[model samples]
Target chain A: MAASASASAARPLAGDSLTIHVSSRPQLAMVSALPRSSPPTWRLGLGRPARLSTRSPHARSVRCLAAGGGLAPEMRATLDKVVASHKVVLFMKGTKDFPQCGFSHTVVQILRSLDVPFETLDVLANEALRQGLKDYSSWPTFPQLYIDGEFFGGCDITVEAYKSGELQETLEKAMCS
Target chain B: MGVTKEDVETAITSSLSPSHLVVTDTSGGCGASYEIEVVSEKFEGKRLLERHRMVNTALAPHMAEIHAVSIKKVLTPAQAQPQPEPAADKAQA
Candidate 1:
């Protein structure tokens, strides 16, 4: 957790990279058709057999997701590429060396304890990126973890995963890949 | 102004409709942090991570003011029944 020498590119939101991403991984989409009476059970479990769908009919429109925290399409594309480039990515409130938030620090400490080589993107340093990520991940908070181009979960999930030895297993697979 | 612990409890109870609930103000004096235990049938088939996510989502509106929230326990009524001791209290490290 040495902050890892700025692995993230310094591209501001001004210059949208002209990269058209054919997303190989499943992107976040709202399951609006599901009844609100129950918690969305379909979104549970990581890398389940059902997650292999490259295209689901429910994901017809680009705007199927709710109000993005104003994260632009191009910015999301850059993030998608970022998640793909690294086996592990942590978008947190601060750098790993000096994590500004408790939750971010906890997740950083967990990753460090596991001794897996991971990159950190300090959301606090970039406002647009910070807000953009909340929308990009469809998760409202910081310390969002991505293992092998997948949104693993937040601080609590990371802690639970660490305790159950799931995080290690996932990271090991990602590292080998 | 910060949110009270009851506000957090209200949000969670209304959403999860837990059979058992305990909301502790872990912030000492302030209303910024809480330690919660919720046992509900809604969590019957859900994984621990998803259970926590449900709690987090329910409290999303109040999250701006609250500094931290530790969801200590989320279990179904069946899981809660067999336990002799308070699961949430003993489970924390």
Candidate 2:
């Protein structure tokens, strides 16, 4: 019980309630506990969705997703597909390594510090994406965040969430699934 | 030939009926850059991004004349207030 508790604290967010836990040695039980809805299953992104609960690394990569920032019907649908493409996605001012704006840089730092895998779209490179994103989120700013294919908020909101530890929890959940 | 800040503000006011409105010419002498802060009932339930879109959509026709537009503050009447830095005084950054 103490070992489980320590593991929980170390992770604290990912793969908790969302996944059914099983020990490595008990291979048969882990295989049986796998959800019926889960795909036929390969060990690709998260190493067999069945073992997601026990492993932390797989959960982290699977959570990166796209931020749906396209407002038109066709573009909106495409963006929806993109959000599901990765586990975490950020529509930012610059690329992950070189942020063009201060606000975009702040978000990049937050994601980096968390050490979670994330994908970024550089709005600065494309005028249509930039303008369309403004319409899509209806927030007149760059550096927007999307979790689980939903708009979480922008730089200020991300900062506030980070301060209150909510961002960590959200990211943990994202990483878990 | 050129668009004025008042033109932009008036269009937004008519469309969104904001509680407060401020428009500034950021282009020095030319009507290129503009900054705006709008507080409106329509902004309720909408995020800052959405509010800015409404402004952007309303001004889409003048995109040719307007170059840099910074939406400094977008809030409903309840959320809008006298912050330490008002949108009127914010720098381009």
Best by TM-score: 1
For lDDT, the strongest prediction is 1
Cα error, candidate 2, residue A34 (Å) = 28
C-alpha local distance difference test of each model: 0.67, 0.59
Write down the worst ten-residue block by lDDT for model 1 chain A. A1-10
What tens-digit string does per-residue lDDT give for candidate 2 at B2-37?
A: 788788887888888887788888778578778777
TM-score to true structure, per model: 0.71, 0.52
Off by over 4 Å in 1: A1-70, B90-93
Q: What is the DockQ of each candidate?
A: 0.26, 0.18
DockQ of 2: 0.18
Could you give the C-alpha RMSD of every candidate to the true structure, in order shown?
11.0, 14.5
| Model 1: per-residue Cα lDDT over B39-80, one tens digit each | 999998987767877888899899878888887778899988
